[model samples]
Target: MTTLRILAAGSLRGVWPDLMAAFHHQTGLTTDTQFGPAGLLRQRIEQGERCDLFASANLHHPATLLQRGLATDTGKFTANSLSLTARRDVVTKNDTWLSLLQRDDLRLATSTPLSDPSGDYTWQLFGKIEQAYPGWGERLKQRARQLVGGIDSLAVPTGELAAQWLIDQKHADLFIGYASYAPRLIHHSHLQVFLIPAPFNIQAEYAWAMLTHSAVPLATFLSSAAAKTILRQHGFT
Candidate 1:
């Protein structure tokens, strides 16, 4: 069988390797995988990069490819929600979600907005917080350090999850990212994860699309029961 090339979102890094190994075993087709910010990956494919399958953190990227005639179709395989990862003590001490984030001295970190859907969801949460608290949207935006998933993000080597790395390096007291990544973001045993509140929660949809003219039919495999089981194991709904 031919080697299949796949470009996927960074958030799926934890599970993709093992999942694809299973795929290979079942189909006898080897795959070459690349993972990065979803939007950036989409841009690369749009720029004529060769890839058989594109899996993204949001439908928008694949939908754009479909409209551009770069992909045949798109289908959602899993879904995730935004969440906060922080030091256990810090989370336990805060009585309210907004208050924790609003603390004057606390440093917050998030993926870059517009470049990564996680950052976009973080911005949406800020907007909701602004609605509830009044005058805090701009404040939150100003204080958040865009550490990953932007045009200017520090160069993270391929296959590395930047948010988890930043948290491990103690770049900030808190990080905003996909809930599926919470387990990896906790650098220590004491780190904790908090679900984004109902009002601010954004369910991130992950979708896959077969590139136009690609010989590999990965879109159908993405929807298979085996794939869904692996996604769920990685925290996707």
Candidate 2:
């Protein structure tokens, strides 16, 4: 049996274990996986890391690979959105998403931009927030703790989600990350998940490409409704 090597985004970590198991059961093909920020994964591939498939949290990375002739083509297989995840005990009862984010005393954690799409999305959201309330964009960005993303995110322990662990360590009062990760933290950690309403929400687009044509079946399977159902069950919109 051939072991397909897959490079995927970190936020997908929560879903991949079971998803890969199901995929293996269905196709009888073994897989070896690496998960981290999509941009960094793209960098790895650019640096000549061998991978059979490339799954990214945003369209840009995979499209970049295709443009550079490193991958055959790309397909968007899943979707996600950004949300504010706060430690339940630390937030005030009346805190709305905006209010909580605006609090002067609040500490916000975000992924590192340019290295993680989640951070890039958070920056986009800051722009949207500025449109709603001028001057707040720069304020939020100035205060946000870039705890994850870039090469640093690659250091996050296996099976341990970054934001959840950060909250547990009292690093920040809240964090902005993929909504897909929110559900797991809420269930397993003392966290509260809040979806940023439309007008402020940044829609996250996830895509994948075949670095090696032999991995096409895995890409097709990921795009199928069966895979989508599993993703949705895990909180990916």
Candidate 3:
């Protein structure tokens, strides 16, 4: 049986098993998935990691893959919502990050822009801080610095491990991450998401592509119904 090697974003860690099982059943091609921050995966590919499918957490990541001749565009499959999340304990009395974010003791953690699509969405949110309340971003950032060593915003690893870290360490009052990963964290930890209404929410466009070094048949199969169903079932859309 042929094998399909895929490099995907770490946020999809929760849904990977089902995606692989379904694809294998349909195509009879075994799947090997390498999940991590999109930027880190790109570095591995640049260093000559042989791969078949490229599923990324952001449109730009997939675009970059095709631009550098690393993959073929298969277009975005679905979008994930970005929002602020808090641990259940920290969120009592119907309070949310938007309401308490300006508190002198609050800290908001996000992933590094250097290696995450979620990070880009976080930065975009900072620009729209006024939508929640005027001048909120500056006030939040100032206090965040004194608590977390100094920073305008907080960043954690862009991996599934980071999800556990958030709950284990109680690192910050809130975090910005994809909805897919957020729900899974709740199952295993003390974290919960603050739902940003549609008016203030942002969607992250995700994509799947065919790696240049892959066997054409394997890459082609990723765009087939089997893969699409798997991706969609895992909340790709």
Candidate 4:
């Protein structure tokens, strides 16, 4: 049996294992998978890394590959939204999601833009905030510390949640990341999860691209009801 090669976004790490297992059971196909920042993975593919399929946290990366002739087809598979994860002690009784972001005394951590879709979405959220509040968005952008998700960013230890690890390590008082992580982060005794409200939040579209004809079966499987059920179970929309 030829094992399918898959490269996926780091955000999918929690769900990919189960997804691959289901894919194998249903189709009798094996897969070898790697997870990392979607943009960095796309860069690797562009540089000639071989994979049957590439799944990204945002549509842009996969679309870029299709446009550049590096992929044969690309389409969205699932969706996610942003949320704020703050250390329990850092949040005050008077704080709202917006206010926590505006406070200068608290450190704000985000993924690195251009190297991660989460960071790009955070910037997009800032843009929406800017539209609503005039200058606050740019201030948030300036204040945000790109702590992880870059080519040279600190490596999050395996089996650890990025938001939890970053906050527990004292890197930041607050982290804006995918809301899909809320279930896991909410259970942490020292963390508080806040859902970013509409008009200020950005929707992250996860897309996948076929790098070779051999990927068609896996790509098709990704869109099946079983796959969607697994995605929803893992907090994807």
**Candidate of highest TM-score:** 4
Q: lDDT tens string, model 3, 6-102?
A: 8887777766787667656766768788877787777788789988777777877777778888776556655688756676676669686577565
Model 3 CA deviation exceeding 4 Å by range:
130-134, 138-161, 213-236
Per-model TM-score, in order, reads 0.90, 0.95, 0.79, 0.98
C-alpha lDDT score of every prediction, in listed order: 0.81, 0.87, 0.66, 0.94
Report the Cα lDDT for candidate 1: 0.81
lDDT of 1 by residue, 201-226 (tens): 88888898788445345666678899
Model 3 scores a TM of 0.79
Identify the superior model by TM-score, candidate 3 or candidate 4. Answer: 4
Q: Model 1 Cα RMSD, Å? A: 2.1
Cα error of candidate 1 at position 108, Å: 0.7
The C-alpha stretches of model 4 lying farther than 4 A from their native spots are none
Runs with alpha carbons beyond 4 Å of true place in candidate 2: none
Model 2, span 1-237: residue lDDT tens: 789999999888888887888888889999999888888889999999999998999999999999999999799988999988887887777888898898888789999998999999999999999988999998999998898987754356677777777877788888898888776777854788888998889889999979998898899889888888899999887
Model 4 per-residue lDDT at 31: 94
**How well does model 3 score by local distance difference test?**
0.66
Give every collision pair in model 4: none
Q: What does the lDDT read for residue 154 in candidate 3?
A: 40
| Candidate structures ordered by lDDT, highest first | 4, 2, 1, 3
